[model samples]
Target chain A: MAERILVLAEQLEGQLTDVTLELIGVARRLAAPRGSTVDALVLGEGVSALAATVPADRTLLMEHPALRLFNPEAAQRALEAVARETSPWLVLVPNTSLGMDVAAAVATRLGWPLVAYCQAIEERDGQLVATSQLFGGKILADCPVGTDHAVISVLAGAFSSEAAAPEPPARIERLAPPAELDGLRVRAVGLERPEAADVDITRAEKIVAVGRGIESKENLELAEELAEGLGAVVAASRPLVDAGWLPRSRQVGKSGLKVKPRLYLALGISGAPEHLEGMRDAELIIAVNTDPKAPIFDVAHYGVVADLFEVAEALQERLGG
Target chain B: MTLAVILKQVPDVVEELAIDPSGTDLDRDSVSYVVNEFDEHALEEALLLREATGEDVVVVGVDTTGELDQALYTALAKGAQRAVKLVGDVEGSWLSTRALAGLLAPVIRELSPRLVLTGVQAPDDLDGQLAPTLGALLDWPHTGVVVGTELADGLVRVRKELWGGIMLDLELATPAVLGIQAARATPRYVPVGRVRQAMRESTIEEVEVETPVESAPKLSRLRAPEAAGRAEMLTGSPSDVVERILEILRARGLY
Candidate 1:
């Protein structure tokens, strides 16, 4: 195999994810600058046929029974096997739930340096420089990766997945699974889908979403009162859900639920990127936080820097609560 | 059988983080430290597992911030059998996640643990690489985003969440590494008095280990996320703010 930009194509339940295309798009950009080619790696049992549409210079599809499902152990082995032989200068993996599972392991296995949570990748002075987010997107760090081989995990949504006007890879190579996948230490027993939300925030017309600023669980009652006045559903940020103050169904964020209600009343949510990704499209956004710098204010159309308790209480009173 | 939980002290995000003169790291002098949230969850999971299986739970951490003692003592107060602090400059300009894992892997292997748990992700190791890196170095299977774990015959059954909140049940052989996202239950709160007593009684075991050769990604700059500047400020007291909010909603015919 020739040296090129390698991309780990992501798929779920036999369908390729849009993020994989986004990775390919990024891989193309990174490869074009240096006249390097791009190779997409797809590891699965019967999903290799799906690689026909990958927008790369070449596609290397590996298959094994252990890869019938998305097992990190098997996926890592396949990626490491391919990377060892191809010796790609740059490898891109989607910074997603599954990608997070395997990217670091693959990099470590290959003895290559890795930069995770990378939102931007650019080569400077013949060196790979990546801008990665830290502190849940509160801070951005631009760093230079190793000179030799580097693995980059690209976060989704940084680039659009418009399908690149439909250009498929010209060459496809089918490879046998490495013997390492024969008897994996880890095996997926089964998968469980998320339980139906008690009240689906996605369909709700109005939502009163509270965050850490709610302080204690008792304050949730204030949000409830305000929600009732507005005929809205009650929602919360990850902290409120993680603390068990609110049910998971009512949580709003990357790991929670994406909601775009008619009106989103954000109280005390710092609006981490994960949280913002879930609810930045609300028809009307009103945010209240003690800190004027809260990212929620950036997304909110009308912002107030005030104590959440006072604001919620006053809003309830104004609404005849 | 033992479950080793790795603890770390990260800059408390609540504080105003100031970039150091290096422009790549935080201004440590101004920042306060707190237990990494996920590691606390890791310890909580290990403790919970120990409560059921009677397996010993040991807490270990690298004293990068020089404040690892408080975290270790609190772990002891919360029912860990022992605490280890690897104290030394493990070959780095700073303690990168890879270096921290390299430094701890040898010592953890010496303990002969059945399972090792750490936070799935920290602000510093936002990619959640500690578990996988340690696993790779130790030649053990590793997984992240794990929420629940149970001990069975010779392996551990874990409940992990995949993308879009899909849950999956997987079984990994013993001597596995887990990057815990959350525990089955909330972390138990130890009384301040209990922590004080633990500090007075328990002694943290210290060991010196030399990390193998590794190159870490060198950060060149750090900056705050750019604000969108889309918000229209609504000023005044609580009542006035509420009035403006009501007016906005009414304009959208939401009321």
Candidate 2:
């Protein structure tokens, strides 16, 4: 094995995840400088087609009935087996829900240094360096992996998926899951859908998102009025959703829906990196926050440094409602 | 049965954080540390479980940055029965998940806790690895981003938050690790007087854990991310700001 970089390709519902391509993009950047080849490992039943879509030098497929769904226990077993065989220089896992669940355990099992939520990767002095956001995105730490073999979970939307050039028809190889898949300590009991109907925020053209600045659950109606005036759908940050003021479908962030709306009217959102990762690419962003120094201002196209309640009422009146 | 809750102190992100002279770390002298928001939720979850099942809840704090003692005391005020602080110079800048996991595995084994609970992720670490790494070191089953948990028939049933609002319902046997995303309710408030009383009455049992000899990754440099695009700030009264936004939206043909 001549300097291999293993990329874990994440997929859902028989389609490759968008973050999977982004991981491949980061892997290419890290590997190209070192004359290393990027190989992708995709585990799922009947996922060979999805694996072939990976833009890496090769795609390793682990297909089995137990691997059909992305329960952590099954995925970990399959990844550990492949990782043991190929001691790759670096393994890139998507920092998605499933990726985060398995990467740390796998790295620990392999005795490799694990870097989580890596935002950027660079080659310094022929060694790999990873940059991660710390202190709620207030600081960036440039970490140089001390060990030769390391596992990294690449943050979603950190790198543009377009940057990864598709290889000339990636070669696919098949592997089998371990024989004793029967005794899983944790079993997936099936997906529990949110109580509300799924309203895909990704398809929304314009959105009005709320955060902790809303102050109280009763104030949600004010945000809704503003959203109704603007002809935009209402959404919220994790705080509001966690408080049960809004359904999970209306939440936007790393652990929530990643949306690229045309106009994102962020009402009182502080623009934590987790939230920014979701709607950073909106064509026009207008933020209303009392704190002028809010990180939301850093990315906003237009901002109002005022209380959200006052701003929402003013906006509602301005929209002639 | 005993439940262990791991607590961490993170920078108070609401306050402005400044880079130190070295440009590789935060200026600790001027900065204030608060218990990690999620870890507080973890402690609250442990307390909730304890309240329901009468299990003993012990808080383990890694006193890496000299801020863990305060958090431990707060945990005591909130409801933890006992607290243990791991005292050592863990070399903050060079600390990696692997190093922290190594330091914790032995301590966890010593406690032999029936369930280990920690925040799903730390603002400082963001890798969301500590709980899972500790589980792997102990070969115990673990789950992350757990939003809801229930106890039934001596098994822990957890609801995991997956991407796009999908939830995964899982059941795990004891001697398991859980990275709590949120508590069932907001952490109960500990009044100032109660906290002061806890400070005087409670003692943090300090255990001098040996720092690992292994070399971990070091943060070579730190830099503020360059602004992606110049933000056109809107100023004036609230009405003027709203009008300005409307004008821009109309110009973009979005309104």
Candidate 3:
């Protein structure tokens, strides 16, 4: 019998999280050496359609109204049922807040060893080991699971999404969650989705981000106008987020969204490693700052050594934006 | 009311770290250690909570190594009433949140704090796993990235930061574990006078506990991430730099 690895799939409303696909890519790599099959455990209402998208040889779909909103208790019971049935060698989960909640509960109940935020994983000496960056990516730590069964939560964007194999005996099975909604002590009374305007920066292909050098909120209009003219979005460093000048979502750093775009224009942004990690993937980076020795210049494809206000105005005129 | 804050002593994040000559572990000799930054925020939250409720707060350090004494003492200087250190030298690989929680559950059970606070993620692990694992181990409620917190009617109302700056208001029963995110309130530095007093009077109670099982994730191999595509270095006056940038942007079809 070939070893099997199970991936716990998460969905919001009807769309799968990007992490699900990333986990599939990870599982494919983990399973290749052992000729193992990947199985996806999806729990939610109206999830049969999602089964087609899971990159697994088999999918266990648990459909229930209670599972719709990611109730931890019900989700745990459903996963426990699947684990009992499949007995996978490893259980892979996304490292999102929600995923960690479920993964922790399940691992605790099963008494299985777990490694969280794994950046890399491999089998060595017939035992699985994983590596994760520690100290804010300053130090790397290598760990090995002592138990035969291991649970791991993978960081988002650590691996790019890969297409699921064309077709290979894909089977779907329904599981009835063992717990009831009423049994869940914690309930989400309401969910407030951010308005499109609030998250607009995440999708903007061209972004104009400022750092502490921007000085004050009154000067923000300079950055905003440049963004407006260039048809770009405005973002900020952690200080701006702390200052309430920008929302936390618009804060670009290791703790914030890792963004990749066509063009990233940084203004007065000193390139801290935390900030650089988030935008290092952008295709073209342009930095404008007064200081010639700003670290931003190191990663920037293009840099302007001048006052940001003067540079923004001149660039706006030249680009006709 | 009593609050407990969990903290870890991790290598300084800003310093350049080197691996041991053995290539199997960090070069501990050269690395300076500090309290994990997030844990500082957690400690801050614990102090704030104590002040709000006039509760006695005891900070506990589950030290797997003797190195944690300084961190514990620092927490004491910051306002924790007492400190408890668990001693062992378990390998870094066995330091997963689950394993750490297993070691901490007993100590926490004995203390029986009304609430436990931790950093959303440690600067060392950055996994953000500790709070959830501790919650599961204790069968308590867990909340992550909490920006605002209030105690009302014996329940904890936590404001969690969701995607895109939205807040999720959650109410959990007492005996909850909250992973605090950095908020508008900056963590205060320990006053020099308080540090001196704490060092003079504070003595950490050492609790010897069984070392956690070695469950380090195996690392097959590691290499630095491939260098990003090189940027053409432009050296000239500001106008010349601008012209060169425009030319490059146009070449890349940005214009």
User: For each candidate, what is the lDDT?
Assistant: 0.83, 0.81, 0.72
Model 3 agreement with the true structure over B72-167: per-residue lDDT tens digits: 777788888889887766623326566677788899889888889887777544333678778877878786777777777667777776544555
Query: Where does candidate 2 chain B have its weakest 10-residue lDDT segment?
Result: B89-98
lDDT of 3 by residue, A85-155 (tens): 78888898886756766776677768776666677776777866777655544445566754367788777
Name the candidate that leads on TM-score. 1
TM-score of 3: 0.80
Evaluate every candidate with DockQ and list the scores: 0.68, 0.64, 0.31
Fnat per candidate, as a fraction, reads: 0.75, 0.79, 0.32
Assign candidate 3 its CAPRI class.
acceptable
Ranking by DockQ: 1, 2, 3
List model 2 lDDT by residue over B113-168, tens digit each: 88899988887664446778788888888888988887766578888888788788
Candidate 2: where is the Cα deviation over 4 Å? Answer: A124-127, A145-147, A163-166, A179-182, A195-200, B90-94, B126-128, B214-217
Residue A294's lDDT within candidate 1 is: 72
Q: Where does the lowest 10-residue lDDT sum fall in candidate 3 chain A?
A: A180-189
Tens-digit lDDT track for model 1 on A229-292? 9999999987778788887788787667778899999999888777887898888899989987
